[model samples]
Target: MKNVIVRGYDIPAKTMVIANIWAIMRDPGFWKDPEVFWPERFEDSDLQYKGHDFHYIPFLSGRRICPGMNLALPDGMKPEDVASSEAIGLLFHLKTPLQLKATPVF
Candidate 1:
Protein backbone atom coordinates (compact mmCIF):
# COMPACT_ATOMS: atom_id res chain seq x y z
CA MET A 1 0.00 0.00 0.00
CA LYS A 2 3.03 2.27 -0.25
CA ASN A 3 2.94 5.28 -2.57
CA VAL A 4 5.70 4.73 -5.11
CA ILE A 5 5.72 7.59 -7.54
CA VAL A 6 7.03 6.28 -10.83
CA ARG A 7 8.03 8.80 -13.43
CA GLY A 8 8.02 6.17 -16.16
CA TYR A 9 6.49 2.73 -16.54
CA ASP A 10 9.32 1.00 -14.78
CA ILE A 11 10.20 -0.09 -11.25
CA PRO A 12 13.28 1.55 -9.78
CA ALA A 13 16.01 -0.54 -8.25
CA LYS A 14 16.10 1.29 -4.88
CA THR A 15 12.40 1.99 -4.42
CA MET A 16 10.90 1.78 -0.94
CA VAL A 17 7.81 -0.38 -0.59
CA ILE A 18 5.57 -0.04 2.44
CA ALA A 19 3.16 -2.81 3.45
CA ASN A 20 0.82 -0.79 5.63
CA ILE A 21 -2.63 -0.87 3.98
CA TRP A 22 -4.35 1.09 6.77
CA ALA A 23 -1.89 3.96 6.52
CA ILE A 24 -2.02 4.04 2.72
CA MET A 25 -5.83 4.08 2.76
CA ARG A 26 -5.67 7.19 4.95
CA ASP A 27 -2.95 9.01 2.98
CA PRO A 28 -4.09 12.55 2.18
CA GLY A 29 -2.18 12.64 -1.11
CA PHE A 30 -4.29 9.85 -2.52
CA TRP A 31 -7.46 10.62 -0.57
CA LYS A 32 -8.88 14.00 0.31
CA ASP A 33 -9.59 14.29 4.05
CA PRO A 34 -8.63 10.65 4.43
CA GLU A 35 -10.18 10.48 7.88
CA VAL A 36 -13.67 11.01 6.51
CA PHE A 37 -15.79 8.31 4.88
CA TRP A 38 -16.01 9.46 1.26
CA PRO A 39 -17.06 6.96 -1.36
CA GLU A 40 -16.62 9.75 -3.93
CA ARG A 41 -12.87 9.14 -3.66
CA PHE A 42 -13.55 6.18 -5.97
CA GLU A 43 -16.28 7.79 -8.03
CA ASP A 44 -14.06 8.35 -11.10
CA SER A 45 -11.27 5.91 -10.29
CA ASP A 46 -10.46 2.90 -12.49
CA LEU A 47 -9.53 0.69 -9.56
CA GLN A 48 -11.42 -2.55 -9.06
CA TYR A 49 -11.42 -5.35 -6.49
CA LYS A 50 -9.83 -7.74 -9.03
CA GLY A 51 -6.39 -6.10 -9.06
CA HIS A 52 -7.09 -4.14 -12.25
CA ASP A 53 -5.37 -1.26 -10.46
CA PHE A 54 -2.71 -1.68 -7.78
CA HIS A 55 -3.96 1.33 -5.83
CA TYR A 56 -6.99 -0.09 -4.05
CA ILE A 57 -7.45 -3.65 -2.84
CA PRO A 58 -10.55 -3.66 -0.60
CA PHE A 59 -10.61 -7.37 -1.28
CA LEU A 60 -7.18 -8.95 -1.48
CA SER A 61 -6.53 -10.22 -5.04
CA GLY A 62 -4.82 -13.22 -6.67
CA ARG A 63 -5.16 -16.83 -5.60
CA ARG A 64 -5.54 -15.63 -2.02
CA ILE A 65 -8.51 -13.41 -2.84
CA CYS A 66 -11.02 -14.77 -0.28
CA PRO A 67 -12.31 -18.08 0.94
CA GLY A 68 -15.89 -17.06 0.36
CA MET A 69 -15.18 -16.43 -3.31
CA ASN A 70 -14.06 -20.02 -3.76
CA LEU A 71 -16.54 -21.58 -1.38
CA ALA A 72 -19.05 -24.20 -2.52
CA LEU A 73 -22.49 -24.92 -1.08
CA PRO A 74 -25.62 -26.82 -2.01
CA ASP A 75 -27.97 -25.25 -4.57
CA GLY A 76 -30.84 -24.82 -2.09
CA MET A 77 -28.53 -23.93 0.84
CA LYS A 78 -26.53 -20.79 0.25
CA PRO A 79 -23.75 -19.43 2.45
CA GLU A 80 -26.25 -17.01 3.97
CA ASP A 81 -28.24 -20.01 5.11
CA VAL A 82 -25.39 -21.33 7.26
CA ALA A 83 -24.51 -17.82 8.39
CA SER A 84 -28.00 -16.89 9.63
CA SER A 85 -28.57 -20.33 11.17
CA GLU A 86 -25.37 -20.02 13.16
CA ALA A 87 -24.67 -17.79 16.14
CA ILE A 88 -23.51 -14.92 13.92
CA GLY A 89 -26.98 -14.37 12.44
CA LEU A 90 -27.10 -12.07 9.39
CA LEU A 91 -23.82 -10.42 8.52
CA PHE A 92 -25.49 -7.18 7.51
CA HIS A 93 -28.87 -5.43 7.73
CA LEU A 94 -30.12 -2.40 5.79
CA LYS A 95 -31.81 0.58 7.43
CA THR A 96 -32.67 4.09 6.31
CA PRO A 97 -30.55 6.85 7.80
CA LEU A 98 -32.55 8.98 10.27
CA GLN A 99 -30.08 11.48 11.65
CA LEU A 100 -26.30 11.45 12.12
CA LYS A 101 -24.48 13.16 14.99
CA ALA A 102 -21.08 14.63 14.22
CA THR A 103 -19.52 15.25 17.65
CA PRO A 104 -15.88 15.34 16.50
CA VAL A 105 -14.73 13.97 19.83
CA PHE A 106 -11.25 13.42 18.47
Candidate 2:
Protein backbone atom coordinates (compact mmCIF):
# COMPACT_ATOMS: atom_id res chain seq x y z
CA MET A 1 0.00 0.00 0.00
CA LYS A 2 1.52 3.28 -1.11
CA ASN A 3 0.14 6.56 0.20
CA VAL A 4 1.07 10.12 -0.80
CA ILE A 5 0.21 13.03 1.48
CA VAL A 6 1.00 16.70 1.02
CA ARG A 7 2.75 18.21 4.03
CA GLY A 8 3.93 21.73 4.96
CA TYR A 9 2.43 24.90 3.50
CA ASP A 10 5.65 25.91 1.77
CA ILE A 11 6.15 22.52 0.12
CA PRO A 12 2.89 21.49 -1.57
CA ALA A 13 4.48 18.32 -3.02
CA LYS A 14 3.29 14.95 -1.77
CA THR A 15 5.27 12.85 0.67
CA MET A 16 5.04 9.21 -0.25
CA VAL A 17 5.15 6.31 2.17
CA ILE A 18 5.37 2.83 0.61
CA ALA A 19 3.92 0.08 2.73
CA ASN A 20 5.51 -3.20 1.60
CA ILE A 21 2.95 -5.84 2.44
CA TRP A 22 4.61 -8.37 0.11
CA ALA A 23 7.98 -7.96 1.81
CA ILE A 24 6.39 -8.22 5.23
CA MET A 25 4.52 -11.37 4.22
CA ARG A 26 7.69 -12.94 2.83
CA ASP A 27 9.98 -12.06 5.75
CA PRO A 28 11.53 -15.36 6.81
CA GLY A 29 12.23 -14.11 10.35
CA PHE A 30 8.53 -13.86 11.11
CA TRP A 31 7.29 -16.62 8.83
CA LYS A 32 9.13 -19.92 8.67
CA ASP A 33 9.11 -21.28 5.10
CA PRO A 34 7.74 -17.90 4.12
CA GLU A 35 6.86 -19.05 0.59
CA VAL A 36 4.68 -21.83 1.89
CA PHE A 37 1.14 -21.44 3.18
CA TRP A 38 0.98 -22.47 6.83
CA PRO A 39 -1.85 -21.47 9.12
CA GLU A 40 -0.09 -23.22 12.02
CA ARG A 41 2.43 -20.35 12.12
CA PHE A 42 -0.09 -18.30 14.11
CA GLU A 43 -1.45 -21.18 16.20
CA ASP A 44 0.06 -20.27 19.58
CA SER A 45 0.74 -16.57 19.10
CA ASP A 46 -0.93 -13.36 20.30
CA LEU A 47 -0.31 -11.58 16.99
CA GLN A 48 -3.41 -9.83 15.76
CA TYR A 49 -4.84 -8.10 12.65
CA LYS A 50 -4.64 -4.58 14.16
CA GLY A 51 -1.03 -4.24 12.85
CA HIS A 52 0.38 -3.43 16.32
CA ASP A 53 2.65 -6.53 16.23
CA PHE A 54 4.35 -5.51 12.93
CA HIS A 55 5.02 -9.18 12.29
CA TYR A 56 1.90 -9.30 10.15
CA ILE A 57 -0.76 -6.80 9.08
CA PRO A 58 -3.21 -8.43 6.69
CA PHE A 59 -5.70 -5.65 7.39
CA LEU A 60 -2.98 -2.95 7.30
CA SER A 61 -2.09 -0.42 10.03
CA GLY A 62 -2.63 3.11 11.30
CA ARG A 63 -5.67 5.33 10.47
CA ARG A 64 -6.35 3.45 7.20
CA ILE A 65 -7.00 0.20 9.06
CA CYS A 66 -10.13 -1.10 7.32
CA PRO A 67 -13.17 1.19 7.04
CA GLY A 68 -15.61 -1.69 7.61
CA MET A 69 -14.66 -1.79 11.28
CA ASN A 70 -16.37 1.58 11.73
CA LEU A 71 -19.66 0.25 10.33
CA ALA A 72 -19.93 -2.46 12.98
CA LEU A 73 -19.52 -2.02 16.71
CA PRO A 74 -16.03 -2.85 17.92
CA ASP A 75 -16.47 -6.42 19.11
CA GLY A 76 -13.15 -7.64 17.63
CA MET A 77 -14.72 -8.76 14.35
CA LYS A 78 -12.43 -6.84 11.98
CA PRO A 79 -10.27 -9.85 11.26
CA GLU A 80 -13.18 -11.79 9.84
CA ASP A 81 -14.41 -8.71 8.03
CA VAL A 82 -11.31 -8.39 5.84
CA ALA A 83 -10.68 -12.09 5.34
CA SER A 84 -11.75 -14.12 2.22
CA SER A 85 -14.98 -15.44 3.70
CA GLU A 86 -16.47 -16.37 0.32
CA ALA A 87 -13.49 -18.48 -0.69
CA ILE A 88 -13.44 -20.21 2.70
CA GLY A 89 -17.17 -20.83 2.51
CA LEU A 90 -16.82 -22.38 -0.94
CA LEU A 91 -13.98 -24.62 0.21
CA PHE A 92 -16.09 -25.76 3.14
CA HIS A 93 -18.76 -26.93 0.72
CA LEU A 94 -16.46 -29.37 -1.12
CA LYS A 95 -17.94 -32.81 -0.54
CA THR A 96 -15.33 -34.84 -2.39
CA PRO A 97 -12.18 -35.85 -0.52
CA LEU A 98 -9.29 -33.53 -1.39
CA GLN A 99 -5.70 -34.68 -1.56
CA LEU A 100 -2.26 -33.34 -2.35
CA LYS A 101 0.16 -35.67 -4.10
CA ALA A 102 3.88 -35.20 -4.08
CA THR A 103 6.87 -37.50 -4.50
CA PRO A 104 10.32 -37.19 -2.95
CA VAL A 105 12.92 -37.51 -5.74
CA PHE A 106 15.84 -37.30 -3.34
Best by lDDT: 2
Q: After superposition, how far is residue 41 of candidate 1 from its true place, in Å?
A: 2.1
lDDT of 2 by residue, 1-106 (tens): 3343446334334655566798887887877798886655665878665546865454456876656433432354444344333324534544333233344658
Cα-lDDT of candidate 2: 0.56
Clashes (backbone N, CA, C under 3 Å), per candidate, total: 0, 0
Off by over 4 Å in 2: 1-14, 58-106
| Candidate 1: pairs in clash | none
Best by TM-score: 2
Candidate 1's residue-wise lDDT over 44-101, tens digit each? 8665645567564434567756554433454565435443322333654334212332
Q: State how far residue 90 of model 1 sits from its true place (Å).
A: 13
The segments of candidate 1 whose C-alpha lies over 4 angstroms from its true place after superposition are 1-18, 58-106
